[model samples]
Target chain A: MKRIALLGMPNTGKSTFFNRLTGASARIGNWPGITVDLLSARILLGADMVEVVDLPGFYDLHGFSEDEQVVRQFLQNNPIDLLCLIINATQIDQQLPLALQLRRLGLPTVAILNMADEAEQMGIRFDAAVLTAGLDSPVCFVSAKYGHGFSEARETLRQVLERNPPTNAAIQHTEFAADEALLAEAEKLVARSVSMPRVLEHGLTERIDRIVLHPILGIPLFFLALFFLFQAVYTLGGPLQDGMTWLLTTVHDQVLAHLQPILPGWLYGLLVEGVYDGLGTVASFVPIIVLFFLGMALIEDSGYLSRIAFLMDALMAKLGLDGRGFVMLMMGFGCNVPALLGTRVMRSRSLRLLTMLIIPFSLCSARLQVFVFLTTALFSSTQAPVVLFALYVVSFLTAFGTALLFKNRLPSREPLLIELPPYRLPTFKQVILRGWHEVHHFLSRASRFIIMGVVAIWLLTHLPPGVAVGGPQSLAGIFGSWLEPLLRPIGIDQQMAVVLLFGFVAKEIVLGAMAVIYGLEGDALSHLMAQRMDWVQAFSFMLFILIYTPCLSTVATLRSESKSLVFTGVSIVWSLGLAWVISFAFYQSARLLGY
Target chain B: MSMVRLSELAIGQQGIIGDMDAEGQFRQRLQSLGFRIGKEVRLIRQALFGGPLQVRVGSVNVMLRRCDAASIQIWAER
Candidate 1:
């Protein structure tokens, strides 16, 4: 299939446009699912089969953000047959540099002036014929949200294909030199077709910016926004989450009853307990995670996310991290995997590495299961969200504090510089598509990893090799014994110690180990531990989790991204040291206080 | 004063980028993105909380944390 790449700046509705062209199924298989990997979908353009690849939205080809690199690689490697370059019409001047470079690359490029409705609202006007004539290529006027000019763009692509276009002979991989010509061409085109005659010189961006950027009140307002975000994640998300859990388990029970008559015990257990229950635990939180992602997606889509970055830039600089660093930190809450993947957005290599080093400190959504499960079991439902929120606060502090120390101790760096896109409403189709893609990814991992994890824990807890009278001689016991000394400072016993040991392999496995140790009710282990260990031990456990070694895949990715064994090793050591010191401090202080 | 830090400057305050004193990998990055001297810049947006400030230079909207903003020196617009 001929690959068609969708290219644009962040918040230009690139994904929205991709969904309009290729539909949800294409995007699910491609970029939205993994968040790290670029995804492709096949489209039938009349008789020709075209592969539409939705690339990460980025500013210019010059930056080092992972998404930008994705674009750069596609350009350099000549992966796609055609480039569908989407530009937000409102920010044409700012976003045009990348367009200029793509034209110089001599790719069969079509420019779709997206968000035309928003542009019209702002009283901006453009002549498409003039734009097309100026760029020397077909330009289509599209509002991806409203589905305008989409078919025309596809037709234009078909026509471009029919021409039997010569493989862009001018497309040589050289920097600045090649871009110089493209920039000149774009400047000429903008001068002819696009006109912005200082319309409303002092607009909303300027008016609202004063108080928002004001030294005294700005920080407090930002905190309130974050407080509301966390509150919404729980208060709004709770009932929906409870309803989803009931629905999934109800289905699981019905399926078990239907199969029980024909199937044997092991077979039934394997299907219902091993696969259904385990995967259900991971999938049960989909509603809350989806809601959380939806809120984030909307903010990002509306261009408000950049404003948040703009607002936080100063605070981050105070903490010794830059503005771009906030993106990686926010992404960490989604999943540490992609958060680490997102470090590529940092313009500097050290900042990228620094962000990566601190990412694990940001509490991922998947780990919320462990936190909520532990807190609710030990305390009340009302106290659960607060406790969990506190842990998140601790995690945030850990990231900031570590970044500060690293900045002061490691080396000082330049201030941040980033492009800020204007805010716009994200489409439902796009939100659902992106959410579905991410949900599918979590399910895929659960199917593959959760099954193996359950089976392994089952074997470790059961069998001829199992412990006699359940007193630490089983397979899990042997592993726990090896890990006991290491975890003793954190006040964990052999059993809890083993869970921590397996936590390194995959975080979800920590849940699996708990299930095995405490039976169907994970609360049994939590309640028992709550009696022996006070609040300090719990805090210590949270700290260790925050700063300890990342799961295996993260380590591998760090190696690949950093391309240095030494850097990876340093990350592992520093994380371990930080965890140890924090946990040790908490444990010692607790003992000193007679807790 | 020679140059006030970019983050400390009020919105609409214009200045020339004086120095970017960041180090390590990010230092190399600052060099690559044309954040060099003589570029005209102004603060445009600030977040509600003591967050990053959005600044404009030429045609670009660059967001920097207040702290990083402090690292950048700028002369007031004449």
Candidate 2:
């Protein structure tokens, strides 16, 4: 099938336009490289089903940035039928040069002046006919956010495809002299075709940036934003999570009651106790995950996230990371899978690798759930938040400290540089769509691993005919007892060891696994946990869960992102070593203090 | 008539880029970002602790490290 690549500078509404045309929820963020990977969908235009690929946004085709390289490589490998070059209309002077360069490639190309609404609002006017005449291509004005002038864009695409222009040889010869000449010509063309507002308006974006990016207030406001973000995730998503858990439990119980007599006891137990409960435990976190993504989308779409990179640059630089890497680490709090993918935003491989090494230390929501459950159960309501906050701080410190130790060992590359797009109010639809997409991605990617893990645990606990469930006679029981001595130093028992094993699948399952191991359900499980473990042991357990090896999905992502067995192995070993040492220290010291 | 490094410009100060002293990919990257010679730019802000400098080149705002900024010669507007 013929392909049309949607190419643009970073944060130019290219992904938004791609989503509008293809009806695919390609992630649209106000920051750069949100669409790190090329997202292609079969889009129907005037009865022709052409593949539309959304390439990662870049400033110039000749640039050496990773995203730019991805775009360049893709163009070389895949023959595109039409090049849909999207430009921010307000920044046409800066954007036009790339468009002019792309035009020389001699592909049947169309230039889209995206965000025309914003341009108009800012009193920046562009005469499309003038630009079209100068470029020898159709230039259409479009607001992808509001679905304005899309028919013109679509009609242009259809016409371009019908013309079927041949790819020119100019694309093959990319000399710096030619690029400079093209840029010079582009500068003249932009000056002639576009008119700027006489009085440059100091608009809302600047007003907000005054406070948000203030020398003193920026950092504190950033933390406040984070505090509220976590607060929203826990507060708003709490009841929904409970509702989902309650609903899933009901379904499992009903299914078990119905199937108990029909299926063999082991088979029935595996289906309900193993698969349903295991998957259900992970599933229960969907609400919070959705909320977290929603919050991130809002921040990202409003363009505050880039400012975060701006504010944290100095601190991040100290750890041999860019502010963008810090943004990715913060993203890890929601889920490490996407955060691992987020590392693609970093231009250098070494930087990406180092950032990946540190991300697993962030307290992901799954781990957060376990901490929330334990802390709430074991401590007073007032102390619960403090304990959870302390865990988050520890997670940050661990990630930063890890980065510091490895920064020098890793090969150094480019320094931190980023674009801060003007802040705008995120649309309600976009936020909801992003949230839905995240939840969908999570379920599809993580469910199989979770279910398989739970089933494996079920087998270990249920195997050997006539063996007691989860008792010393079963496989898990034997394994846990054998491993118990190693864990005993950290105040962990056989039950906790087995639950930790199951937790390797996903952190949220530790709670459900705990309920199963202790042969209790719901509130009784919490009560039992409180009665059995002292605050010190509970705190140690939380610390271990906070720093231990990432869940199976995260490890899989690490393997894929790093594309090295050694790196993945190192990640696991490092995390395990840290968790052991830290938890041991905490437990031992607490005892020494005679608390 | 003095040409000052871009890093020397105060926040909100405007200038016309005179010469870029960087080479190869770094130079190309900056040029691609609308920092070509004669392009008008304004220093938007500087991050704390000698972090990146946020500069407005034409309509686009970009953050550049102080080291990179120091290499770009500009004629500051009075």
- What DockQ does every candidate get? 0.28, 0.33
**Most lDDT-accurate candidate:** 2
Predicted candidate 1 versus true structure: per-residue lDDT over A433-497, tens digit per residue: 77777767766765576677766666665544425522477777777788787888777777777
Q: After superposition, how far is residue A68 of candidate 1 from its true place, in Å?
A: 23
Error of 2 at A555 (Å): 2.8
Show model 2 residue runs off by greater than 4 Å. A1-202, A248-264, A411-413
lDDT score at residue A499, model 2, on the 0-100 scale = 85
Task: Give the range of the ten consecutive residues with the poorest summed lDDT in model 2 chain A.
Answer: A27-36
| TM-score of candidate 1 chain A against the true chain A | 0.62
What is the iRMSD in Å for candidate 1?
A: 12.1
- Recovered share of real interface contacts in candidate 2: 0.58
